[model samples]
Target: MYAVYLFSITWAIVQSLPQGAPPSVCQTLMPFHGGGIRPQGGLSPYTIVPRRQGNHIVVTMTSALGIPFQGFLLQGRTPDRDIIGQFDSSSVNEGHPLDCGTPSDSITHNSPNDKNSIDVVWSPPRGYEGPVIFNATIAQEYETFWVGLESDPVHVTKRGANDPQFSFPLHNNGPTPPNYIPRQVKQNSAEFDPFYQGCSVTKLCFGSPANCVESKNCKAAVAVTVAGDKYDFELKAESSAVWVGVGLSEDDKMGDDSVVECVKRGNGIAAFMSYTNGNPNYGAPRLPNPQLGIQLLNSSIQDGAIYCRVRRDALTIVNGKAFDLIGKKYNLLIAAGSSLKQSSVGFHDLTYLASAQSQALADVSALAAKSKLLIRLHGCFMIAAWLGTASVGILLARYYRQTWMGRQILGKDVWFAWHRIFMLLTWALTIAAFVLIFVELKAWSGERNPHAILGTITTILCFIQPIGAYFRPHPGTAKRPIFNWLHWSIGNAAHILAIVTLFFAVKLTKAELPDFVDWILVAYVVLHVISHLILSLMNCIADRSSERRVTSFPMKDLGGPGRNSAYSDRSSDAPYSNFRRGLLAVYIVIILAIVIALIVITALAPIAESWTSFKSAVAPTNAN
Candidate 1:
């Protein structure tokens, strides 16, 4: 009896992990340690490298710094954090599929043996064309392990719709059906203007500037036409854009929306349908099963534009939810951009116009563009806060405190008084701008945009500043120096963060600001730094000159009223006082100019429309 009990205990210990990590650890990637030992911290002693080879990716995991590991689990993952793509059986070594419910989705070591490296090949299913990453978990032994180590991204471009690798048949499957329309429509063709032929009459034409289809000058547009049980879609965008897409959304936002995109790769165009679930970073944009709903008619890249024609099922399922487009109303969101952010489309910096309101998808009439009033107001307020008021407040607190020592207004020192007012204005403007953005989005922004996170942090820091100042320690107290340092540190941090946040805001699609806005931010940084350097030099010169001056007579103050007059007011007669005043005036002028320029740019975004208006107005005068 005693021998059988001991054998059972030893067998339980061996069963824990002698073969490999169990299927239960597939997602968590943790070793089952009944002893409560946790995985080691910091970076793992293992490394994974993924190299893309045509339609496949070769993933290799090796020990770092000659630290051979004993066990590991591997999987191919998407930006959605989904475990996808089956590992090749012929290429795998010392590992086999764990069958983590999703067959072949994960691989694990066969035995607990110290190994140098394992190389495996993975093939993604057809139409999962976005990006893929290799995720790995490695263990030196049972206790010393690392979980969730990831490899660099590998982007996958979809094959052309006509290619043999595509979802549709390589050749024409059968004779053209009676209801079939023309397959290809050359862009800007002189033979026929097919896409815009029925604009606002037979088809629902949607694009920017509200009259682009009629005027025959649209950078990106979508024309939707409803047939018996299918919807024909024509998407057009400037060839400069790598991809263009149209989404059917109940609202202006991208959450839970069905997005159909035409991607330009090599010389041909490929079509895709994705589900964007609001998380621009981790959403399942490549939800797959696209062939069940969309049939590509033809696509082309010609005459400075890219175009694709498709027929979609009137009732289709995306991400397991049925979306019916026959009689339902949806706001058409048409966007085009030059790049893709992994699975998610890149910022539609080129075009991001939405229909004014939800309307029938079958409406064969004009669709008004959504007003960007709130977006413009948010941008303008942010500029007015950080660029205008914040700049004034920081400069005053740093440089003018010495110059305006003797001047007082409203029982407060002149410099401090003005600084307080400017800072308070900044605080108020920041809060208002913060509120406006929340009102616009109506929810927390996704993690993909660093601007949203940094902007929130900047606002929080700004809010805490006034509260800190109100409860600050009095002068010369034990904690006064500490309070001063903390105050200065927080103020500088908030100012720096605000400027950085503004730079990121240029990339936000909703802002609609032009790329030149980045140059504007750079110009401000350069000018701001130069001004600081100049003021610092001036202050150093003043301090050095004052210290080096040898007092010929220490009692001169008793001898003359002129002694007090010469040095009494730094604002009036000390050192290069007039030169400092001139610098301050110049600084204010340039600062306000840049701030106002940015505000104007935000007010009339895209900047191109305003330029077109200016040119149109001038052309008539020139003709006269």
Candidate 2:
């Protein structure tokens, strides 16, 4: 009988809990399956009291007339019933915090024990300055509950137009624009909120993950709102990043753009405007412009995230380019890095994104990263051009020159025919890869990395090789020797340069390849050198053996013309066919293996992530 009583209490406890979970819905705070029952309509024994604490509002849900309620669901909201701020998670235990859209958006009771009051630390929503109130639902028993209990109204601090700090002079300050006023002055840090509050609806907001802002879970985001001649930009980096910035560019590329950034130094956060001179290596990347038209509104550093609000001119000139935020459509560049030295920041190795299309600076949308198809194609084609086709072509022309003497391919010596085929394949792939990259960038890449310049030179050399081969003198001509020397020099130099360019490609920020890719390239180079050395040794041995055979076995017997011809051939030549073919097979296999490896790496440039996803797809089979 005691056990049955215990089971009944356990069942009641479960039945008395609110619906869904901790973050109770704004409309339905009552327990699920209680719709059939009517709530108490008389004066609720509960009342809510709200107290102000700086920028936050602390709400108290307690007995109005000394009546203790067993359970309650509490939330703060604006006038239109939209859930406003999140309750602090640490302040609630029995009634856990809920994640409606933002973290701790709602809090409700999970236990059934009676209590006089539940004090939930409710704070106002970030960036929201409208009036707010706390409404709570209290339940005395499983079947008895009260709804529509309300608290006194509270108003958040607003930035009025008459505020002197926000007023700006209409005329330009000569070459200098307005300076940034630090929010560190106001000493008002609570105004710092998620930058995505007014995203897309009232501002031009963009960031990574595309949906981060809409989902209320942005890692790095920017929202720009038009306010007369001035624009309000709220930026957020949901990480311990040293800096985060947004820039206006004519194209998707990073250089020649105008950047406004917030750097976190020591304990304070500040915003600044700078220009990147287009070439990463040619000039300083972060050239601070104290005269730029930028103003700091508010900023904060909490939980390692960097949030700042700033105002910028709608029309200004940066890097000699007329930056009319309201008139011109522009591609946006958002970047952040881990290190900062004064005004200069380290490479945007953490998060670098370019918008998919150009938009008027005042337009509203999330940041969609430009498609990387062209970039991927460019890398793959280059790998095939240099690593696979070019290497094989060079090998054939080097070692197989004398090996395929008897075999004819397309009316030419087999070695010469195959060599031409591979070389032309290399030429075609290289040219296509070159063209594709230009098409992707729409201009000559002004990146600071050497890969661009090195690849271009390699392409030029590869292009001249085929043209030079086509115009070569006949084999017996005096100039034939010169042609062969030039051809060898150019081909070898181009091949070496191409290999080195591939090495530099691994270091490119846009490449997104891991450092281990350098080791892969190193292995390819080592294997290629070893293969060449083996072939050279074999060629020398074959020559020595041929010489000894010819000297030892002399044609002493006089014979007729046909027989004499055959004997002469045997005496002059090395044994033609079998061993060289076997050697070629081994060489080709090794080359193909390396080529396939590089191609795989290029096609899946971000290889580790791809591998993880692949493993996840096949994990069930392995488990089984």
User: By lDDT, who's the top model here?
Assistant: 1
Which pairs of residues clash in candidate 1, taking residues 3 or more apart in a chain or in different chains?
none
lDDT string, candidate 1, 120-219, tens digits: 8877766667667677777776545666777766666566532212121132212111121112334534213456766675568898644465555566
**Model 2 weakest 10-residue run by lDDT:** 173-182
Q: 83, model 1: CA deviation in Å?
A: 62
* Candidate No. with top TM-score: 1
For all predicted structures, in order, the TM-scores are 0.62, 0.58
Report the Cα lDDT for candidate 1. 0.72
Task: For each candidate in the order shown, give its overall lDDT on alpha carbons.
Answer: 0.72, 0.67
Q: What CA RMSD would you report for each candidate?
A: 24.5, 18.5
Per-residue lDDT of 168-206 in model 2, one digit per residue for the tens? 124221211111111123422222233444456546777
**What's the lDDT for residue 152 in model 1?**
62
